[model samples]
Target chain A: MKLDSAGLEILSGGECLNLLASAPIGRIVFTDRALPAVQPVNFCLLDGNIVIRTAPGSKLAAAARNAVVAFEADDFDATFRTGWSVTAVGHARAVSEPEEIARLSALPLTPWVPGTHDHFIVMAPEQISGRRLSR
Target chain B: MKLDSAGLEILSGGECLNLLASAPIGRIVFTDRALPAVQPVNFCLLDGNIVIRTAPGSKLAAAARNAVVAFEADDFDATFRTGWSVTAVGHARAVSEPEEIARLSALPLTPWVPGTHDHFIVMAPEQISGRRLSR
Candidate 1:
């Protein structure tokens, strides 16, 4: 909970989750061909896990299955030079159960990509950390 | 370039670099402690490479030196359910020479965090790809 020299406030775990819940778009980071790859995706918070819908055979769906990943979201005002960023580190698991997938699809977690989003990847936040830069 | 089912247009390499130059913020994904980690950073494009300033002892600075990383930036309209995302994948190198660092510091690549950002990391975009979702 220490503030950095630039007045960056380290947010608690609860605050980190709250900030994450406030954003709908985030970047999911995973290993691709032994190198890091990232892409922006629309997601929702379901039962403390970040849920994202992807199409089968997609790079994200392929790389994220049962893999350690990171999700990051933030809102920064370039003019004001202030913003808060929250990052969630966890392991992503594909939702294979039909009943659970159906239940999750009923939520507001709609994919921005136009197509069948039959695959669901859920990342349970194992480590949540956030920092807010302010005056 | 191929279009997805939902009208997602695959952008060319030149176009991806153009989109990247239009933004000032992006997420840097790197491996930390043998796991993937992501953090939002302020950067600029210089001579076809992504340049960022970081504190000397920051985790990003430590992990990014001579490491393969991914930098992603995007702009999406939730209301319209459309937007474009561009990602740059390359190896990051620390700018150790004082002359280059001084010259780069004169650019608009100011560090958002409050502190001495003497360490400069530059990533030459080896693989650039972008997708634009539109009707």
Candidate 2:
């Protein structure tokens, strides 16, 4: 279906979650020294939380500890100028329990960057919103 | 050149600016009620600043006033697992002068979302960084 260039459809919560689940990567936005920062990372959705692996002592692992952050993912086509974006905002916490970490590691998430990924950060989303632009 | 997965090449300042100038879309990260929030936007590089158009009094326009924000743009190939990302951190200010707004409107920035985008937000970057990953 060809949508109007001005059409921006607001997605429902279920739609947002479904789109998020279909993608394997997203950018995590967090604050560092009172300034906003963003990093692209591969993530997975499990048990209503967005989970990602990070190296120990990394800025992401350090700043995201029990802090509120935003996660965004989008698929855009520059040629067609059509795409959809989803943003989930919530509190991020480090996965401490070894058993839970093992369980999460078993999930289908692989670190895009090469390194020893020893820590898992889970963002239990309190808000999920998305928009799709088509033409 | 096929780069190893472990090789994440750091981009220099000129490289970052060149990448930023090559893309017309990016995500703007800012604080909303002290929580990090991200929104995908269409922007252009002008006179060493990242300029974007937004609707007046929107959350982005409101929170970004004199605020330190982050702007990010990237292109990744999911199949090949290779991409580059550029991020700029700086202060955002509203462009109130009519002449400046008129001049920016003449630039190549076209907002993807349809609306009356009368307000222009200029991000004067203080720091710019980027990374390129390859297989």
Candidate 3:
């Protein structure tokens, strides 16, 4: 196991992607009012890309258009102090073309809330990294 | 039950703080290489301020110094599709003074990993908000 400077195990690119795919929920980081902001969303991994559905006019949609963003997902056992976190940095593009929107709509992605989630944001990660902390 | 435009219930400020205090882990969003980055950390709520400990030379410690960042914590039940999320945005200042650091050392805050977490970052949120999704 490769360990980082802090002694936590460093995850390979494949392991990072696999861990990201295994989780249904993740946090998206974007700039809001020129400062960093985070929002939790249900996401899916498609062809090594991250996809999230949101309202077209939602705050995230506004900030994520062609924007550099970070997506993170993890699971931990607080009692055992063990967990792994995966972070993917990429450019978020809003799907506006009818054909692309139709394609994404066919995916299993669904919003966690009850409302219209017609917009699709697809991110192809330029950097994927993860770390695992063991008890 | 106040609902936002997206149909998610908007939680009150007090409720947001309460929920934040209940969570042991949260994702902290900060700028890195001129892009957004997120990492999950175990944190504590003290006097309505968010405090997290990290390595003195860690990436998080460097990026969080006097910078505007966001902290988010949430809990969800995928089976029932019920969840709540709280987001706090403010300036993150690294605590360096000896007396202050000495006082913080007495807190219950502890690092999730097995390493030295001597640097402290505290954020007294200027803006706090939260939302809930019901099944």
Candidate 4:
């Protein structure tokens, strides 16, 4: 679909989801201390949810406790002027089952920051939506 | 400071803050439904905090219940390759006081989404950090 904006193109649903599945990193959006917040997170798609590992006292641990939040992943190539974004709105909670933790740990996501990866936060989507912009 | 990325020049602290102050729209990040989430929010900088209006059943109302979330705002001009980003990390909570709500409503922030603007989420930053990239 063509977007009204100059040099903007809307992507099909299949193409948008494909971009999301292939992208390794995305940004998570939430409220921190009563304001808007975002952070770059390395995540993997597991059982139709986004899984991320964090430190005990990290922001991720604090934001995922029994609340609804939004997660977005996007890929942009300036040279090509092509980009796609996938947003998931869902509830966030900690994954504490020993077996689940072990399984999640096996995923390819590794925290670039130095810390113990004890806190596992998962975003389960109640609604999954996406859009793509291209030139 | 100089960043190695091409066409990406680091912004001074003051300049970055200025851009943040001027931008009227931004995206909020949090965890929801067990994953990372993001939503576009209209906000105003008030007393060293970011404030937004939302519906009671909306995602914003859910993410801010009790979490450490990250909030970020950025402005970019592709033609000039100039942009700046401001990110805040802090706790989120509901504002229940009648006097405070009345005061906050007076701010320029008006919810564009259709709903009762009954939920007021605030993000009080423990740390405010920002960066700007210019050509």
Candidate 5:
């Protein structure tokens, strides 16, 4: 789909979600040290939840104890002059149950950056919304 | 500065911070119901804190009662072929004190979206970090 400058002005909700589903990575955003923070992670949309893996003492591990967090994924096609984004808001918690962890870990979520993928943080969405710039 | 594909690959820590300082809007990330959530907000890099305005029943109001959250902002320059981003992670709390609220509300944070902008949520960064993809 080729998009002109004008076509990139407004995006529909379905297109936004479709874009999000296709992207395998996104930025996990949260507050740390009284400031805004973001980190890149490999993610998967499983049964309507966002899941990622991290090591102990990592920010993801620490955030699992928090009450809420937000996650976002986006893609921009310069050639096509189009882009889409999706944002999810919900509670983040660590998945410690052996069965659940194993099941989630079995998914295809290989981190682009190499590190210990020990901890798993799941962001369960209470509300999912998005926007797009498309022709 | 003109950023080519290669020049946009590497971004210094200071550059990232400066980009963050210049931008007035960011995405607030949190967990709503075991799911990832994000909302756009007008923010300020005030005294090292990220602040935004919202209504009483808004997501920001509810997140203030939580222990932690994340915030992120980014800018992409297709012309210059460069982009920069910054992320903050820390605890989020509501500014209840009248004086503090008044002081924060005084900042130039006009909502791009129309609605009741009453409640104020502050993301106090325990850790601030960023990266840039430059050419």
Candidate 6:
């Protein structure tokens, strides 16, 4: 395993994707009012793309329209300080076509909140990286 | 319990701070190379300011210098779809004064990774808001 300058193990592309696929919740970072804002979201990986189901006309859905955003997920044991973090930088675009939405609707995408979350935002990562730290 | 248009309970300032005080870790949103990025950092509340200890010359340390960044913390039962999220938008400034740094070093803020984490960044929230979602 290759180690970064920070002593954390650098995860390969496959390792990063596998780790991302295992986590149920992740954080999405976007420019809100010209400042950085983060919102925790439950997301899933579909066809190697990060897919998010959010409420229509929501802040996230509006800000994520064809914009470059960052997605991060991790599982860390605060007690032991041993964990892995995966971050994907991508262009987030809303899926408006019916055929495309229909295909994504078949996925296991479920929102934690009880609301109308028909808007689908798919992010195809341009850069994916992660690191693993051992206690 | 006051509810927003989305039906989530709007938490008061006291409630927000109490919830933030209970979390061991949170995600810091800051602009990186002209794009938004999120990194999970273990933090603590000091005099109602969000304090984080990180490597001296780290990316987070550099980007967070005297900038308006957003900090978010939450505790959620993903399975039951219940949780609360608190977000604080504030200006992040590096604590350079020896006496100030010395005081912050005394806090319970401990970095998850082992290293020389003497640099301190304190964010005094200008706008703090949060909401709780029920199962």
Rank ordering of all candidates by lDDT, starting from the highest: 3, 6, 1, 2, 4, 5
Candidate 3 chain B, run of 10 with poorest lDDT = B107-116
lDDT of 3 by residue, A63-90 (tens): 9999999999999888998999999999
Q: What is the Å distance of residue B86 in model 2 from its true position?
A: 1.0
Per-residue lDDT tens digits for candidate 5, residues A1-135, read: 443222323445555556667876677766555444566666887877788887767755775565566677776544443456677667888888999988987988764434467678888777566655554
Top candidate when judged by TM-score against the true structure? 3
True-structure lDDT of candidate 6: 0.89
Please, what are the lDDT tens digits per residue for candidate 5 over residues B21-135?
A: 7875567776655444566566776777788887777655786565577777776553443456676677888878999988987897765444567678887777665656554
**Taking the candidates in order, what DockQ does each have?**
0.72, 0.63, 0.83, 0.19, 0.14, 0.66
Question: Which has the higher lDDT value, candidate number 1 or candidate number 2?
Answer: 1
Q: What is the lDDT of residue A87 in candidate 4?
A: 79
RMSD in Å for all candidates: 1.5, 3.1, 1.0, 9.4, 8.9, 1.3
Count backbone clashes in candidate 1. 0
Error of 3 at B72 (Å): 0.5
Chain A only, candidate 2, TM-score: 0.92
**Residue-level lDDT tens digits of model 3 in B23-121:** 989989999889888989999899999999999999999999999989999998888889999999999999989999998999999887777999999
Writing each residue's lDDT as its tens digit, candidate 1 over A1-135 gives 589654589999888888888887988999988989998888999888999999988989999999999999998888888899998899999999999989988988877766788899999999888999875
**lDDT by residue for model 2 over A1-135, one digit each (tens)?**
333333578888888999999886799999887778899998899977899898887888999999998999988878788889999999999999989998998988877778888799999999998888877
Better of 2 and 4 by lDDT: 2
Worst 10 residues of 1 chain A by lDDT: A1-10
Residue B71 deviation, candidate 3, in Å? 0.5
Task: List runs of model 2 lying over 4 Å from the truth.
Answer: A1-7, B1-7
lDDT tens digits by residue: candidate 4, B46-127: 8777787888776668777877776777655434545566777778788999999889988877654334686788888787
